[model samples]
Target chain A: MSLLRVDDLRVRFTTRRGPVQAVDGVGFTLERGEILGLVGESGSGKSQILFALMGLLPENATLDGTIEFTGSGPTMVFQDPMTALNPYLTIGLQIAEALPKGLDPATRRARIVELLTRLRIADPGARIDQYPHQLSGGMRQRIVIAMALAAAPDLILADEPTTALDVTVQADILDLFRAERRDHGRALLLVSHDLGVVAGLCDRVLVMYAGRIVEEAAVDDLFARPGHPYTRALLATVSSLAAGDSELATIPGAPPDLGLPIAGCAFAPRCAVRIERCIEARPAFRALGPGHRAACHLTKTPGTES
Target chain B: MTLLSLHDVSVRYRLAGGVLTAVDRVSLEIAAGETLAIVGESGCGKSSLGRAVVGLTPLAAGRMSWRGQDIATLDPAARRDLKRHIQIIFQDPLASLDPRMTVAEAVAEPLAVFEPKLSRAERSRRVAAMLDQVELPAAIADRLPHAISGGQCQRVAIARAMILGPELLVCDEAVSALDVSVQAQIVNLLQRLQRETGLSLLFISHGLSVVRHLSRRVAVLYLGRVVETGPVAEVFAAPAHPYTKALLSAVPIPDPIAERDRHRIILAGDPPSPAHPPSGCVFRTRCPDAIALCAEAEPTAMALPHGGRVSCHRYEPSGQAPAPGLFKEDPLGTN
Candidate 1:
C-alpha cells in the first residue's frame, strides 16, 4: 500500500475580493521510502497541498477531498528556519518539544543531543544552550530538520528547506536528506520552485501550474521526454552554467490570477504549442506511458508528443 | 576607456563592538559597455561594493574615480549630477518602490528631478516609452505597486531605473526573486538594453548560472575580499581558488546524470563571524587547502596565465607549493 495518498485535493481561500481556488483538484500518491518532488512556481498551490495534509491551513482557508496515510503523521521542515524556530527558546528545548511525551528530562536531553550530533552539527553539547539567533542560516535549518526527525515519523515534508541557504550549504542539506532516506527508509515530499533541487533528489516529479497538476512522471522521464508544453517551457528556461550561449527559451505570459475563474487549461495562454481545443475545454490527465501522465490537449495529437 | 575604477577600496561600518570592515581592500575596473558580475554568498561584501560604487556607503579607504574624476571629493551639485548616470535596481521590487505612488509617476520621478526644464507632457511621454521598452502595458501605469504581479512590478522598476538614461546600472539580485520564466525575460531585456544603449552593468548575484549568462568578467568575493577575478568563461571552466571551486561544485545541475556523477567539495562548518574574522586569512578557517603559511601571512593577489588574478597561499611565487596529496581524503566525506 502507498504510504500517503491524496485524491482530488482542493484548497480555497475566502478573501475580501472573492473565493480564490488556490489548489484545484490536485491528486498524487507517495510510495514507501520514495522521494516525490512537487515542482512549481509561486502560487502553484504546491505548498498549500502540504499545508492541507498537515492540517495547518489558515482560518480563512478551506480544503476538500481525502488524504490517506498508512503511517504516523508527516513532519514538516519549513522554508525559513528563522521564523520556524523559536527565538526565545534554546535549540535543545525547541527540539525536545517535538519528542514523544512521558519521557524523563535526562532522556529527552540525551535524545536532543543525539539528533543534533547526527545532523553533523559541530559541538552539540555547547550548541544546545545557544538560541536560534546565535546560529547561522545553515545551522538553523539543520536544527529544524533535527526537530522534524525527533518523532521518527515515516514521512517528511520539506518545503523549500534550502532555498534561503547558500549553494555550498544547500549541498550539505541535500546530502543530509539523502542520508535520512537511505538509512531510515523514510518517505519525503519535497516542494520547491527550483528544478535543479528536484532533479537532484526526487524519484518521481509532479509539475504544477496555477493550481493544478499539469504533468507527472519519473525523474529521468520527466526531464528526458516531457509530455506537457508547460513542462517543456519550464525545463528550457532553466539557465545552466554548462549550457552554451543560446538565448534562453521563455514562457511569454504570466500565470492566471487565482481569484478569477480559469477557463480551459490554466497554462494554455502561455503554452507555445497550444491548440484551439485547449482554449475551449479543460485537458484531462491521460496516460502517455507507464507511470507517466500529462494534462494537455496537444499530447493527444500525433507528432506533438514531447 | 574605463568608466569606473576603484583602487584598494574599503568600506567600514561603526558597530556597537568596534568597527566592522564590510568591504576590505578591493580593486577592479569596469570598461564602457561591459558587464562585470560580483559573485559570492551572503555577507561576502558584494552588496557593499555595489553600494560603495553608487556613493550610498562612504568608503573608509582607497580611491574611486568615475570618468577620471574622484567621486569622494565631488561637490553636492556634482554628486546630484552623477545620479543621472548611475542608478540601481534592488532585489525586492515592491519593497523598493513607493507603495503610494502610481507606476507612471514612479517612472517619471527621475526625469522630473534630473531634468526640471522638461514639460509635464514630455515627462509623461518618456515614462510611457520606457514602460513600453520594459514590455509593461500602458494601462497598468496608474495602478499602485501592490496591484501588479512581481514580474510586472520588476518590469516597472526596470523602467524607472532606465528612464534616466543611466550609463551604469547596478543590479543587486534583480532577477533572483522572480520565477524562472520571468527571470529569463528580465535577463534578456537587460542584455538587449545594454547592447542598444552601450550601458555598463555592475551585476551582483549569488547564482553562478545567471551570472554566467549575463556577465563577461566575474569577480568572486569572500569575506569582503576579491579572491578571484577573470573572464567568466575561463573562471568557470577552470577556477584557480579553492573557494571558487567549492562554490561551483556546490551548484546542483539540472541534469540528473551529471549531478549524480559529479564530485563535490563540501566545505565543513559555516563561515566564521565577520566581526571576529580569523587572523591573516579570513577564509583559512573553512578553506580545505589551508596551510601554516596561510595563518602566518595573507596571500597577495597573483596574476594567472589567462589574464585573471587569484589570492591563495597554495600558489606561491617562490616555487614552494603545498603537498600534492594533502586533501585527497574528503574532510566532509560523501564525495
Candidate 2:
C-alpha cells in the first residue's frame, strides 16, 4: 500500500479578484522510503500543494479532494533555516515540542539529543541549549530536520530545504537527509525549483505547472528522455557549469496566469513544439513507459513518444 | 590590450574595533567585450570587487584603470559622467527596481538622469525599444513592479541598465534570486544583450553554472582574494585550486542515480572570518592541501601551465613548499 495518496487535490484562494485555482486536479502516490520530487517554477502551485497537504495553508485558502496519509501525518521542514524555527526557542526545546502529547520531559530530551547527534550536529550537548539565531544557516536547518524527525513521522515534506544554503552546505544537507530517510524508512516529498536538487534527492519526479501534474517519471528516465515539451524546455533552461558559456535556450513565453481559467494545456503558450490540438483542449496524462507518464496532446500516439 | 585592469586592488572598511579587508590585493584584467565572471561563495568579496570598479567603494590601495584612464583620479563630475558608460544590475529585482515607478518610467529614469536634453517622447520611445530588445510586452510599460513576475522585473532592470548602452555591465548575483526556469530566461536574455551590444560583462555570482553559461573567462574569489582565474572552459573542465574543485563538485546535478555515486570534495569547515584572516593563506585554515609553510606566508597568485592563475602554495612547486605535519596539529573543526 502507498504511504500517502493525494487524489484530485485542488487548492484555491478566494481573492478579491477571483478564485485562483492553484493546484488543479493534482494526483500522486508516495511509497514507503521513497523520495518524490515535486518540481516546478514559481507560482506553479508546488509549495501550495505541499502546504495544502500539510494543512498549513493561510486562513483564506480552500482545499478540495483528498490528501490521505495512510500512516501518521507528514512532518514538514521549510526552506529558510532562520525563519522556520522560532527565534525564542532553543534547538532542544523546539525538537522536544514535536514529541507526542503527554510524553515525559526526560524521554523527549533524550530523543532530541539522540537525533541531533546522529545528524552529526556539532556539540550536540551545547547546541541543544542554543537558540535558532545562535547556529549557522545550515545548522539551523539541521535543527529543523531534527525536530521534524523527532516525531518519527511516516513521511517528510522538505520544501526547498537547501535553496537558502551555500553550495557546499547544500551537498552536506542532502547527504544528511538521504542518510536519515534510508535509516528510518520514511517517505520524503521534496518540493524544489532547482532541477539539480531534484535530480540528486528524488527517486521519482512529478513536474507541476499551473497547479497540475504535467509529467511524472523516474529521475533517470526523465533526464534521459523527457516526453513533455514543457519538461524538455525546463531541462534546456538550466545553465550548467560543465557546459561553459553555452547559451541556455529558454522557453520563449511566460507561465500562464492562474487567475484566468484555462481550457487548454497550461504550458501550451510557452511550448516551442506546441500544436493546434494543444490549444483547443487539455491532454490527459497517459502512460508512456514504466513509471513514466506525460500530459501532452502531441504524445497521444505510440510513434509520437520521444 | 585589457579594457579594464586592477593591479592589487584592495578595499577595507573601518569597523568599530578593527578593519575589515573585504577585497584583498586582487589583480585581474578584463579583455575587450569579454564576459569575466567573478565566482565565489558568500562573503568572498565577489560583489565588493564589482562595487569597487564602479567607484561606489573607496579603494584602500592599488590601482584601477579603465581604458588606460585612472578611474580613481577622475573628478566628481567626471565620475558622475562615468555612470553613463558603466551599468549595474542587482540580484533582487524587487529590491533594485523602484516600486512607485512604472516599467517605462524606470527604464526612462536612466536617460532622464544622464541625458536630460532628450524629450519625454524620445525617452518613451527609447524605453519601448529597450523593452522590445528584452522581449518584454509593450503593454507592461504602464504596470508597476508588483504586477510583474521576478523574470519580467529582471528584464525591466536589464532594459533600464542597457538603455544607456553601457560598455560594462556588472551583474551582481543578478539571477541567483530567480527560479531555474526564470534563471534560464534571464541568462539567455543577458547573453543575447551581450552579443547585440558587445557589452563587456563582469558577471558576479556564487553559482558557477550560471557563470559558465555567461562568462568567457572566470575568476574564483575567497576571503577577498582571487584564488583562481582562467577561461571558463578550463576552470570548469578541471579546476586547479582545492576550493575551486570543491565548489565545482558541490553543484547538484538533476539526476538521482548520478547523485548517489557523485564524488564530492566536501571541505570540513565553514569559511574563516574575513575580518582577521589567518596568517599565510586565507584558505589554509580550511584547505585540505595546506602544509606547514601555508600558515607562515601568503601564497602568491601565479600563472599555471593550463593558462589559469591559482594562489595556492601547492600549485607553485618552485616556491618554499610546505613540509608534512602542516594540518595534523591544527585540523579545523567542522562546527
Candidate 3:
C-alpha cells in the first residue's frame, strides 16, 4: 500500500470577509520511502495541507478531504524549533516521550543520546540534560529533529524545518535528513519556500499556488522544463552569485486573495504567456511526460516532454 | 571615493553570562555609489555591524567618518544633519512600521523630524510622490499596515526610507522576510532607486544569493570578524578563506543538475557562543582545514590575487598558499 494518499482535498476557513479556501481540490499520493517536496509562497496553502493531514487546523477551518495513511500516525516537525518543544521539559525527556510507552529508563536515555549524536550535537551526554533555552538555535533544531525521529516511524513531515536556521547550519540539517532517508528508507514530505533546498533534497517537487498544485515532476524535470509559467518564473528569478547584474524579472501583482473565489486561472493576471482560454476555463492536469504533469493551458502535449 | 568609512569598529553587549562581542574589530568602507554586502551565518554579527553603521547601537570602540569628516567629533547640529543622510530599514517591514500609523504618517514621520518648517501641503505632496516611487498605490497611503500585504508593507517601508533622499542606506536583511517573487520586486525597486540617486548601501544579510545579486563588493563574516572581503564575482568565484568557501558551498543552487553534481563542504558542529569564542580562530572549531597553527595564533588578513583579502593560516604568505581555492579544484564545484 502507498504510505499516504489524498483525493480532492479542500480546506476552507470562515473569515469576516468570506469563506477563504486555503486548499482546493488538491490531490496527490506518496509511495513508501519517497521524498516529496511541496513548495509555495506564504499563502499558497502548502503548510495548511500539512496541518489538515495531521488534523491540527484551527476551529475556523472546515476541511473536506479523504487522507489514507497506512501508518499508526505520522509525526511532524514544525518551522520553529524553539516553540515546537516545551520550555519546561528537558531535551532528553521530550525525546524520550516520543518512544514507546514503558520503555526502560536507561534504554530510553541511551536511544535519545544516540539520536542527538547522529544529528551531530556535540557532547550528547552533557546536552541531554540541558534546557531548550540553554542550547543555541542550531542545537535546539537538532534536538527537535531527534524528538521527531525518536518514534522511528516510516514517514516524516517537515514544514520549513531549517527556515529559521543559518545557511551553514541549514546544510547540516539537510544532510541529516538525507542520511535519515537513505539509511532507514524513511519517506519525508518537506514543505519550504526555498526552491534551492527542495532541489538538493527532494526527489519529486510540487509547485503550489493559490491553494492548488500547478506543476508536479521529478526534481530534475521540474527545474529543467517547468511547464507552468509560475514555476518557470520562480526558477528564472532566483538570484545567484554567478548570475551577473542583469535585471531580475519579477511576476507583477500579488497572489489572489482566497476570501473571494478565483475564476479560471489564478495566475493569469501575472502570467506573461497566458492565453485567452486561461480566464474562460481552468486547466486540468495534463501529462507532459512519464511521472510529470502540469496544470497549464499553454503546455504543449507530448512533443516537448523529455 | 569612499562615502563612508568604519575603522576598527566593535560592539559588545553586557549579558548575564558575560560580555559578548557581537562585532569585533571590523573595518569597512562603502563608496558613494557602491553596494557592499556583509554576509554571515546567524549570530556572526552582520546585523550588529549594520546597526552600528546607522547609529542604532552604541559602539564600544573605533570611529566612523562620512566624507572624511569624523562622525563622533561632529557637533550636535552637524550630527543631526549627518543623521539625515544615513537611514536604515530593518528585516521585518511590519515590525519596523508603526501598526497604528497610516502609511502616509509613517513615511512623513522622518520629514516631520528633519524638515518641520515645510508646509503640510508640501509634506503631503512629497509623501504621495515617495509612495508612487516605490510603486505603491496612492490609495494605500490611508490604510493601516495590517490592512495591506507583507509586500505592500515593505514597499511602504521603502517609501519612508527614501522620502528624505538619504545618501547612505543600511538595509539589514531588508528582503529576507518577503516571499521569492515579492523579494525580486523589492530587489528590482532597490536597484532602480540606487541608479536614480547614486545611493550607497551597507546591505547586511545572511542570504548570499541576494547579496551577490545586489552588492558590488561582499564581505564574509565569521564570529564577528571579516574572514574575506572582495569584489562579489572574485570572492564568489575564488574564495580565499575556509569559512567563505564552506558558506558559499552550503547555499543550494536552485538547479537540480547543478545541485546534484556539486560537492558540498558541510561544516561540523553548531556555531560556538560568541561570549567565549575559540582562542585563535573563532571558526577553527568547525573549519575543515584547521591545522595546529590555527589553534596557536590568529591569522591576519593577507592580500589575494584577485584584489581581495582573507584571514587564514594557509594563505600566510609563507608556503601553504591558501587552501580555499585548492578544495574547489574539482570540476563544477560550487565552493
Candidate 4:
C-alpha cells in the first residue's frame, strides 16, 4: 500500500462574498521515499491541498476528502521562516515544544542540538539558545526544517519552502530536503510555483490549475513530454539559463476566479490548444502511459474514445 | 554618453552597536538607453545601491554624477530637477501605490507634481494615454489598486514611473513578486518602453535569469562589494569571480537534462554580517579559492581581457590565474 493517499480532495472557504472552492476534487497518492511536486501559480489551490491534508485549514474552510496514512501524521515546513517561527521564543524552546511530552530538560536540549546539527546548521550549540531574530534567513529556515523533522513523521509537506530564500541559499535548502528523503526514507509533498525547483528535486510531478490536477507524470517524463496544454505552456514560460535572448512563450490569460462558477474546463480559456468541446464538457483524466495521465480534450489517450 | 556614474559610492547605516556598511565603495556607469543589472542575493547591497542611485538612501562617501554633473554639489533646485530625471519602481506595486486612490489618479499625480502648468483635461488625456501604453484596460482607470491584479498594478506603477519621462528608472526587484508569465510580460514591456523612449534602466534583482533576459550589462554583488561587472553575455558565459560562478551554478536550470548534468559549486556557510564584516575580503570567509594573501589585503578590481572588471586574488598579477577552462567554458552550454 502507498504511504499516503488523498482521494478526491475538495476544499471550500466560506467568505462574505460567497463560497470559494479553493480545491475542486484534487486527488493523488504518495509512496514511501517519494518526492511528489505540486506545481501551479498562486490561487491554484496547491497550498490548500496541503493544508487540508495536514488538517490545518482555517475554521471558515470546509474540506471533504479522505487522507489515508499508514504511519504518523505529516508535519509541514512553511514558506516564510520569519513568520512561521515565533519571534519571542528562543530556538531551543521552539524546537523542544515540537517534541513529544514527558521528555526531561537535558534530553530535550540534546535532541534540539542534534536536530540542528543534522540539518548542517553551523555551531548548533550556540544557535539553539538564540532567538529567531538572531539567526539569518537561511539559518532560520534550517531551524524550521529541524522542527518539522523532530517528530520524524512518515510524510513531509513543504509549501514553497525556499521561495523566500535567495537562489544560493535555496540550493542549499534543496540539498537538505534531498538528504532528508534519501537518509530517512520519508515521503515529501513539495508545493511550489518554480518549475525549475520542481524539475530539479521531484521524483514525480502533478500540475495544478484552478483547484484541480491537470496532469501527472514522472518528473523526467513530464518535463520531456508534457501532455496538457497548461503544463506545456508553464514549462515554456519558465526563463531558463540555457535559453538565451529568445522570446519567452507565455500563457496569455490569467487563471479563472475561483469564486465564480467554472464550467467545462477551468484552464480552457488560457489553453492554446483548447477546442470548442473543452468549453462544454470537463475532460477526465486519461492514461497516456504507465504512471502518466493528463486531463485535456486535445490529447488522445490510448483506449479512450474521442 | 554616460547617463549616470558612481565613483566609489558607499552607503552606511547607523546601527545600535556600530555602523553597518550596506554598499561599500561600488563604482559603475550606466549609459543612456542602456540596461545595467545589479544581481546579488539578499543583503548583497543591490537594493541599497538602487536606493542610493535615486537619492532615497543617503550616501556616506564617494561621488555620484548625473550626466557629468556632481549630484552632491547640486543645489535644491537642481536636485529637484534631478529627481524628475531619475525615478524608481519598487518590488511591491500595491504597497507602493496608494490604496485609496484610483489608477488614473495615481498615474496622474506625477504629472500634477512635475507639470503643474498643464490643464486638467490634458493631464487626464496623458493619464489615459499612459495607461494605454502600459496595456492596462481603460475600465481599470477608476478602480482602486486593490481591485486590480498584481500584473496590472505593476503596469500602473510603470506608467507612473514613465509619465515624467525620466531618463533612468531604478527598478528594485520590480517583477520579483509577479508570476512567471506575468513577469515575462512586464520584462517585455520594460524592454519595449526602453527601446521606444531611449530610457536607461538600473535593474536590481536577485533573479539571474530575469537579469540576463532584460539587461545589456550585469554587475555581481557579494556582501556590499562588486565582485564582477561586464556585458551580460560575457559575465554569464564566463564568470571570473568565484562568488559569481557559485551563484550561476546554484540557479537550477528548468531543463531537466541540463540541470541534472550541471555541476553545482555549493558554498559552505551563510554571508557574513555587514556590521562586522571580515577584514580584507568580504567573501573570502566563504570563498572556496581563498588564499593567505586574500586575508592580508583586499584585492583591487582588475580589468579582464574580454572587457569587464573582477576583484579576486586569483585574477591579480602576483596570484596564480585560474585554469583557462574555468574562465572560458560556459557552464550553461549553448543550446
For residue A156, model 2's alpha carbon misses the true position, in angstroms, by 0.8
Candidate closest to the true structure, highest TM-score: 4
Candidate 4 wrongly placed segments (more than 4 Å):
A239-242, A302-305, B316-335
lDDT of 1 by residue, B1-335 (tens): 89999999999988998988878999999999999999999888999999988878989999999998888789999888888889899999999999999999999988888898998888888998999998889999999999999999998888998998999999999999888888888888899899889999999999778887888899999989999999887677667788888898887778676567667888989987767778877788889989898898988999987788999988644443321111222111112
Q: Across residues B162-230, which tens digit of lDDT does each residue of candidate 4 receive? A: 999999999999999988888888987898898889999999998877887788799999889999999
lDDT of 3 by residue, A1-306 (tens): 789999899999998888999998999999878899999999999999999998999999999989999974578889999999899999998998888898788988889888998988889999999899999998888888888888887888999999999988898899888998889888999999998899899999989999999999999999888889999888777732235445776778889988877878888888998889998788898888988999998887796652
In the range B1-335, model 3's lDDT, one tens digit per residue, is 99999999999999997899999999889999899999998889998999888888999999999999889899999988888899889899999889999999999999999999999999999999999999999988899999999989988988888998999989999999999888888888999999999999999898777877788899888899998999876777667777888887788778777777766787877888888899898889999889998899998888877677888886654454433321244222232
Runs in model 2 deviating more than 4 A are: A100-109, A239-246, A301-306, B14-17, B316-335
lDDT of 2 by residue, A94-156 (tens): 888887878787877777788988877767889898888767777888888888888888899
TM-score of each: 0.96, 0.92, 0.96, 0.97
| TM-scores of the candidates, chain A only | 0.96, 0.95, 0.96, 0.96
- Predicted chain A of model 3: TM-score relative to the true chain A? 0.96
Quality class of the docking in candidate 2, CAPRI style: acceptable
C-alpha lDDT values of all predictions: 0.88, 0.83, 0.87, 0.88
> What DockQ does candidate 2 have relative to the true complex?
0.44
The sequence of per-residue lDDT tens digits that candidate 1 reaches over residues A146-237 is 99999998999999999999988999999989999999988999999888888899999999999999999999989998899999888878
